[model samples]
Target: MARSPQRLSGTPDDQTSPIPGRVTAPALRRGLDILELFLDSSEGLRVPEMTAALGIPRASTHELVGALVDRGYLQPKPGSAGQFVLGVKTFQLGGAYERSLDIVEAGREAARAVAAECGETVQIVVRDERVVVYIVRIDSTHSVRLVSDVGSRLPAHCTAGGKVLLASLSPEELATLFPDDTSLLPMTTRSIDTVERLNRELAETRERGWGEEYCESNQDVACVAAPVRNPRGECVAAMSISIPTIRWQDDKRADYVALVSTGARELSTRLGARL
Candidate 1:
C-alpha cells in the first residue's frame, strides 16, 4: 500500500515551530544595533545618520531613538536639535560594570588585609556625582569602630575617598559634576563649603596622589585615602582607613598613608593599572 503525503503542521513559514533554543528578537537586535552605532561617534549622532548608516527605515529609527531617549540610554545634545548622545544612565551602567570587575573583589581582600594590619576601619568607595558611596568596608579590630558601612554615602568634599576620586576628574568634568556652588553644603565646620576651597583641596590631593579628611565629616573621626586606578591609569576608586581621634597620632599619619597607598597600589596593579 502507498502512503499519503504527510501534511506539515502549519504553514511553511510557521514562526511558532517548536525550536529547541531561544529565538532572536528583531526589535532588541535593532535597538542594540542602534546603540553600537554611537560607539564610533563620540560627539553626537542624528537619526538620519543612524538610518543612513544602518540601512534602517526612517520611521523605525525615529521610534527606536525615541524609545532609547525615553529609557535614558540616549539623550539629546544640549543646543543641538536632532542630535543625540549617551545619557547619564549609560555612564552609570558603565561605572557599574567597572565596579563589578574582578579587581573589586581584590580590592575587598586588600581592604580586609589593611584593616587587619592597621587595626583600624577600612573602606573602598567610588564617586557618584557629588557623593562617594562606600562599596567595601572592614571594621576596626578595636571596640571603637567607625560609623561608616558599605553602601553609606557622604558628600564628596567631606571624606578622604571622595576627595581622592574628585581629584581624578578634569576641571570641566568637575564643574559639570558640581554646577551649583550652593549644593556644596557643609557637613561640618571643617567641611569644604566653597568650590574655591574644594578646588584647592583637590589640587593638594592631586599633588599628593592621596586625600585626607580631618574632622570634616565627623569631629572625632579622620580618614586618609589613596587612589585605585584602572588599566588606563584612571582613578576608579579610593581606598581609605578611618581612625578615631584618640588613636590618631600626628607622627603615625605617614605610616597610615603608606599602608593605604600600598594597598591601593596593589589592588590597582591587580586591576591592570601601570603603577
Candidate 2:
C-alpha cells in the first residue's frame, strides 16, 4: 500500500500557508463577494463595473453574473442592457428570513395570550407550496392537547390554519397550486377531499375573514384560524387555536372564532401590519 501524503496545517487566514486549515470554494466565495458589492450601490452594475470592482478578469465576472441571473439571485436592470440588480428571488429570501425572526418573537407572545385566555392550544403556521408548516406552538393547559409540534407539515386543505393561508392566495395562484386533476389528500374522513370543495371552503373563509375545521386534520380535534398580515397587508402566516372535540361546543364557535381572529390580529400588528 502507498503511504498517504502528509498534511500541512495553518490558520485559514494565513497567506503564506501552503495549505489552509479551512476549505472553501473560490468560485462560490467570489460570487458572494460580487453580490456584496451591490450593498454600496443603489444603481445596477454592468459586467465591466463588477469586474473592475472585484479586481477579477472580465470573463470570470461574466460567468458569475450569468449564473446569478439564471438562478434568479440577480436580474438585468430594466431598459439598461448588461446592467444587473438583485432579483425578486433575492428579495423573497430576505423577506422570508426577516419575517421568520419577527414571527417567532411576535407569534409567541400572541399565542401565549390566546392559550392563556382560552385554555386551548395555539399555533402559528406559514404556507410552503401546497403544505402548511408549523412555526410556533403553545400547548394547552389541559392534559389532552394537540400533539403536532413545531416544524410539522400538513396538507394545506386539511387544517384551519392551512385554509386561512390558502384563502390569502389569488384565484390564479390557487389554480396553479392545485390543478384540476389533482387529488386533495385527507388526514381524516372529515378532511376536504376535493379541489372544488376546498375552493368553496376557501371562498367562505375569505368571506368570513377566518377559517374553521372540525375533525378534519384530527378526528378528535377542532380548530379556528385567522390570517396574520405583514406591514404591506400581505398574509404572511396563520394563527390558530385547536380544541379537543370533547370540548368543542357548537354554541361557542363564534367565541372561538373571535379569540383566534383577535390573536392573529395582535400578531400582525406586532409585525407592523396596520390591520
Candidate 3:
C-alpha cells in the first residue's frame, strides 16, 4: 500500500522514513523505527514481539535487536529467557537531554527568583495520571509556610498548575482521562467538577497563557500557574506560585500574577519551550 507524494507530508512521527527518494535513507529509517518502538513500550519486549510488530523476518529481527543490545540501546531481561528492554545507555542519552534544559535546574532558578522577589512559594509540576505531581519546589522565606513537597501528587482539577496542564488538552483527551465523568473529585468547594465548566476555564487559561485557582485545592490559598512547554512546542510541565488568601487579596495581587507569569515563562524558555 503506497501513497502519493502529498499524503506523505503528514505521515505520523512513528513512521520511520519519508517518501522513497534520495532523502528516504532506508538504514536510518530502520534504526529510528526500532528506537520509536520503545517509546510506547517501556516494558520487556520479546524477539517475537519485535519481529511481529515491525513485520521484519526472524533473522533480521535478531540481528537488529542484537545490534541494539550490544550498542546498549536495549538490554536483556534478568529472569526472562531472551526478552529485551530499553537500556541504561538509552536513559543516559535521555538523561543528557533532561540535563540540557533540566526542569529542575531551570525551574530552581526561576522558582527561587520568583519566591524571593514576590514572597510566595513557587513550584514546578508535571502531569501524572488524573493529577499533577510536584517535582521541584522553592518555598518563600516568609514566616508562614505552605504545605507542599516534591513527589507529592494532587488532584488535577484542584490545583492551578494541574488545571493549566489539563486545560492544554482537548475535550476528547480530557474525556479519555476521566471516562466516568465523575472520576473528577472536588478537593475543595471551588474545584471544577463539570466537564463543560472545566473546558471553559481551560480555554481561558490557553488564551491568557496562565491559570488560577481560588481556594480550590486548599481552601485558604490562591494559586496561579502557567504552562511549560518542550522544544517540540508541546506543554511538558507547569510552574506556579501560591499565596495565602490574606496576602493574595492585598494590593500586591497584580504584582504577584506578573511575577509568577514571568517565572513560568523563564522556566519554559530554559526548557526550550516556544510560544
lDDT leader: 2
User: What lDDT score is found at residue 165 in candidate 1?
Assistant: 95
lDDT of 1 at 197: 89
lDDT per residue for candidate 1 within 1-275, as digits (tens), equals 11112222332223342455654455666677778676657788888888777666899989989999999999999999999998887778768766777855787898988988999999999988989899998889899878877788999989999999999999998898777678798888898888888899999999988999999999899999999999668999999999999899989999999999999998888776766
Q: Put down candidate 2 lDDT per residue, 1-275, tens digits, no spaces.
A: 11112223232122343455755566776687678777556688888887776667899999999999999999999999888889888788768756666678789999999999999999999999989999999999999888988999999899999999999999999889888635588899998987889999999999999999999999999999999998678999999999999999999999989999999999888886766
Superior by TM-score: candidate 1 or candidate 2? 2
Whole-structure CA lDDT of model 3: 0.78
Model 3 lDDT tens row, 176-265: 987764887998888888877877888888888888898999988898887887756688888888988867775666677788888887
TM-score of each: 0.63, 0.64, 0.62
Clashing pairs for predicted structure model 3, backbone only = none
Prediction 2 TM-score vs. true: 0.64
Model 1 residue runs over 4 Å out of place are 1-100
Model 2 scores worst on lDDT over the 10 consecutive residues at: 1-10
For each candidate in the order shown, give its overall lDDT on alpha carbons. Answer: 0.85, 0.85, 0.78
